[model samples]
Target chain A: MIQLLRTLGHLTVDGVWQVGFATRFLFAMLRHSGPSFARFSLTIRELYFSGVLSLVIIVVSGAFVGMVLGLQGYDTLQRFGSESALGSIVALSLLRELGPVVAALLFASRAGSAVTAEIGLMKATEQLTAMDMMAVNPIARVVAPRFWGGVLSMPLLAAIFSTVGVIGGWFIGVVVIGVDNGTFWSQMANSVDFREDVVNGVVKSFVFGWAVSLIAVFQGYDCTPTAEGVSRAITKTVVYSSLMVLALDFILTSFMYIGK
Target chain B: MNRAILDLWVGAFVALGFAALMFLAMQVANVSEEGTRGETITLRARFEDIGGLKVKAPVKSAGVVVGRVAAIRFDPQTYQAEVEMKVSAAYPFPKDTIASILTSGLLGEQYVGLAAGADSEMLKDGDRIEMTQSALVLEKLIGQFLFNKAAEGGSK
Candidate 1:
């Protein structure tokens, strides 16, 4: 048991260092490439794929989440005779945390896993080896596109999630549950701030995108040239990226609120 | 080749769908307009605490939004939160309107609720609201209730 604990500690330390090294490597690659307008195009393509493509899922999920929040929040607020507070709760929760975090998690599950799997399959097929043999930088070709795509898509997806959530909340809270329309909108408008909460959510989405891409690329790049290895890489990318998004969220929230 | 083309079309459709969703959301959030609609009047309130209060938060009378919270600052002399609110021209306010920092629910968001007085003098744009109330924090209220309950229990 003691020996196992030591091994686990060593592995954790090693993993942390590896993550640090990978981040440095990614930044270094970004810096080395000269005036890469091509990267911007790649980012746009990624934005379309990650942001635009994920709309249906995001809207569907957002609607359900907003409805649930209304149902729960309204019921709770009714006890205090303050059911009008439903708008504020939905808007605050969606804009502040749920919208960005849930969207990122969904993106990681859907697109992040796909990115890892595709790259892993390419590696397994020795296509990456062929690029190296031709003296081509695989990082630029493979890692850059996927990374930029994830980064660009994250904020757009987050925006969609927040919007859908608010609308859903409105439908459930005002229309279905019978909170007054004027009260619901007025409460939402009075409670949420564009600069503080909305901007904060957008900023967090960007960070989430970067983290998601990094994890996906790292796992994909490290995959062994085997079928099982590709599957394992895909699994690890989703699990690790989701955990990282949640961890970073807590850290950012703490930093934002701790001293103030 | 056919499969690839089909995939590309599907991708394009997906992208368009997202764009439409964003457009609709932007409309709902009212992202286009910077200033409030219609004519505006101003009111002021002082509070001990204004948690998560933002500049764009709506200023309301009854349940209808008349304007938005224009600015929030701390008074150097009083060490209290000074909140400036804007009201729309559509609703005429009495001179003796009372403003309170109100919550939506037990543990919910804070907003400024206005109650107009019987006085006939209509408040103009940028006029200060003299009467004000601060937010009632749940934790403090709960603590007070518990302490009171405990004291009563002990006495009994």
Candidate 2:
């Protein structure tokens, strides 16, 4: 019984210590971010790896998700004889919820895990240590660029996902199901407010980007310097960022949509 | 990848992202269309019960939208619901135009409908549409029907 209590206390203390460490690491990354902006090409190179490379998965998945929404929405809306509303239903759902949330989840697994693994491997191989010995700031040169790359990539990726998804929905809802084309487009335009739905969705993605990037870089930087530790850190990056994205999504949605 | 190739790919990616945003704003949300709807003048109407008439609900004339509901207020003294509509300047109605609450379908959204009057004077901004009709309540209609049936049966 005492062993169990000791284990629980140890875990509680470890978790709190890690949280404090992460907060400090975040400030360090911010302080060292000047190189990322001043030497913009370095950030762009990282963007190519994280952003451009992730495009195929984001677009293909977005299309499939949208098509599924269209099929299901049509089946249900037809019962109420309100099939004309399918456009708004699909667009609103994609923009308001699925676009930012699902895209961020995918990003957590795809780029977030990769960022962790890359940084963790560099540490394990003593590359970061060598940079410090050579009087080079590894945090500025290595970590900051990758972090900004992710932050810049997330919103653009989310936008592309939603746009592709809307087209996929259109294909299923309009072309295959025989809903009136004009009605579908007009209904979508009439119902979706640019400021209310679209702008809020962009904001949600931006916040998610900031969170997922920070968590990814922090995990990589704080991991134990060993092979096994690097693998575990990569896993933690995916898991923790996914959870953070979902929790933040709930808070943002409540603030944006509830009450009015 | 080579630096030039990387730059090109990033440029293309950024361009595509912006294009997607443009599609959302123009094609899906109709931002430009709303901007081009022309200047509008406000008109007021009062009803006993507005039903589900929401702000931004379309105000139609001859089955075509000419305006949108701008505000809805309640009067304490007369116990009436006051609605303010912003109608486009292009479409002008006479002073005696009737504004009535209407529903599109049985269970669909409610809107405001205007029936023009053959009067010489045109309605202007901040003018009140005096001839106003309240929304039709389904419960009230059913109750009246039942009452009428009971009255006939008692007479018989």
Candidate 3:
């Protein structure tokens, strides 16, 4: 029992150390990212890999989610004889909740995992060490662009998610279900507050981007220089990021909405 | 060749994203009040209690939004809440239009509903709406219900 307790204590210390290391790494990446974003080629390449590639999945999923919201919202609102509220229902749900949350989850799982895996591969192949030998900082060259690319990508991805989702919802709710398009659009405009719903959602995605990117790059940078280790790091990136996105969403929602 | 193509697509993607965000801000958010149904004139009304009434709450007349609540202030002298509204000039009301805080559903968003009254004169900028109603405080109703229950228990 004492041995078990000692092991648990050691794990706790290691966990705290890892968190501190990641925080420092994130700051270093941020510092490196400054002015270095002028090296547009590297950042743009990372952006294309992370952001542009993530677009198809984000848009497709966004449309599907919006369609589901429309169908569900219409069914629920119909009972109240207030089917006119279908637009507001779908719009608010996507803008306030699902758009940021789901897009971030997808971004983390898709691009974030890719980042970790790529970095892990580089580490395993000793390419990072080779760069280090040549008077090159691996973090500046490697980590910063990926980090900045992610931070920039998240809010835009979320916006696309919301816009596509809203349009998709409109397609189903109006075109398919025969709900009035004017009522759909106008009610959405009327009820969905700009600051409360839209701005906060964008803010949420921006923060999520910071978190997921930090996790992805850190995991990659610190992964054991082995094939199995790289695979495990990818898994960790997905699991921890998804958990953090959800947990952070709760905290942010409380601060933004409920505290007011 | 690939780099140029990638840059173009990236540029297009970013623009698409910004456009979507702008749409959300403009259409869904009500962020830019400029050109929001034409010019607006500021007006004020005094209420006993504001409840959950917030700034930017729609001011509707006959179920059509004519303005938004711009600001709220507490008049310590009268212990009343002063609500300032920015009514669209296109939807100006008569001088005697009654502004009441009406809630949607059982307990939902509160908006200022203006009922047109019999008056030849039209309300102008900086006009103080004379007839005003305060928002019903839901907490008070719940407190009253609990208080009655406690009173009945005491009597029993």
Candidate 4:
């Protein structure tokens, strides 16, 4: 009983400590990321590495999800004799929820994990310490660029994902399913509110981007600098970022749909 | 050399992303055309119940959209919901046109539908459409149906 209580207390203390450490580290990273063109190249490189590389998967998955939504939406709407509304259903689902959530999950597993693994490997190799010893601020040189890159790319990736998904949905619903093209497009255009769906969805993805990137960079920066530690950080980046995106999505969606 | 390549890719990536967003805002959201559209005439109508009617819901005439609901409010004196809408200047209606709030489908958004009348003078900006119909509330209809059935049973 005493041992169990002690373990519980230890876990609580460690959790609190980790939260504090992560916040401080995030602030440091943000402080380093200022309006300076000095490290612009570094930021650009990181953006390319993260954003451009992630595009293929984001686009492919978005299209697939959209096609699936179109098929399922058509099937369901057919039951109500309202197959004309397939476009609106598919678009709303993609714009409001699935597009951002799925893209963020893929990003966490792909670019976020890559970021964590790369930074963890650097730490394990003592490169970060070497840079620190050589009169360099490692956070400014190493972490800030990746942080900004991830943040900037996230919303963009999500937009592309949703756009392609809408197109894919159109193709599937109109071409293969033989739904009235005019009705499908017109219903969606007439119904989906810009402020309520698209803008809010962008805002959600932006917040998710910031959160997932922060988690990735923080995990890497504080890794134990061992092989096991690096691997664990990579796994944690994927799992933690995915959970954070979903949790934040739920909170934001509730605020958007009800709190307003 | 590699930096330029990276910069180009990043710029292109950002551009594509912004383009997608622009499509959503302009085409899908139809946000940009809200109030700034060159020629539009504002109109208002009163209803007994708005019934899920919202701002920006399309105003249609003869199954075609002519405008959108601009604002909605309730009047204390008459206790009716006042809806302000903007119709396209090109599709102006007569002074005696009848406006009705209608739902697109069984479960869909509510919109204002205008039926033209024989009045020669067309409605201009800030016109009040006197002839108006309120929305059909499904719940109220069902409740009345059930009540009538119970009353018939009682009589029998």
Per-residue lDDT tens digits of candidate 2, residues B56-97?
888998888888898999999899999999998888899999
Q: Locate the minimum summed-lDDT window of 10 residues in model 2 chain A.
A: A251-260
Ranking by TM-score: 2, 4, 3, 1
Model 1 DockQ vs. reference = 0.12
Give the range of the ten consecutive residues with the poorest summed lDDT in model 4 chain A: A30-39
Off by over 4 Å in 3: B30-43, B49-52, B61-66, B70-79, B86-98, B103-109, B114-130, B135-156
Scored against the native two-chain complex, candidate 2 gets a DockQ of: 0.76
The top-ranked prediction according to lDDT is: 2
lDDT of each: 0.77, 0.92, 0.90, 0.88
Model 2, span A172-206: residue lDDT tens? 99899989999999999988878888999999999
Classified by CAPRI criteria, candidate 1 counts as incorrect
Return the lDDT, model 4, position A177. 83
Candidate 1 fnat reads: 0.02
lDDT of 1 at A90: 89
Which candidate wins on DockQ?
Answer: 2
lDDT of 1 by residue, A1-260 (tens): 99999999999998998878787878865763432345455545555566666778888998999899999999998998888879889888988899889999999988889888888998999998899789877777666777776776678778778878888888999999899998887666555556666777778888998899888877888787799999999999889999999999998888654534
Residue B125 C-alpha lDDT in model 3: 92
What are the runs in model 2 whose C-alpha is more than 4 Å off?
A: A1-6, B35-46, B66-98, B114-131
Instruction: Report the TM-score of chain B alone for all candidates.
Output: 0.75, 0.89, 0.78, 0.82
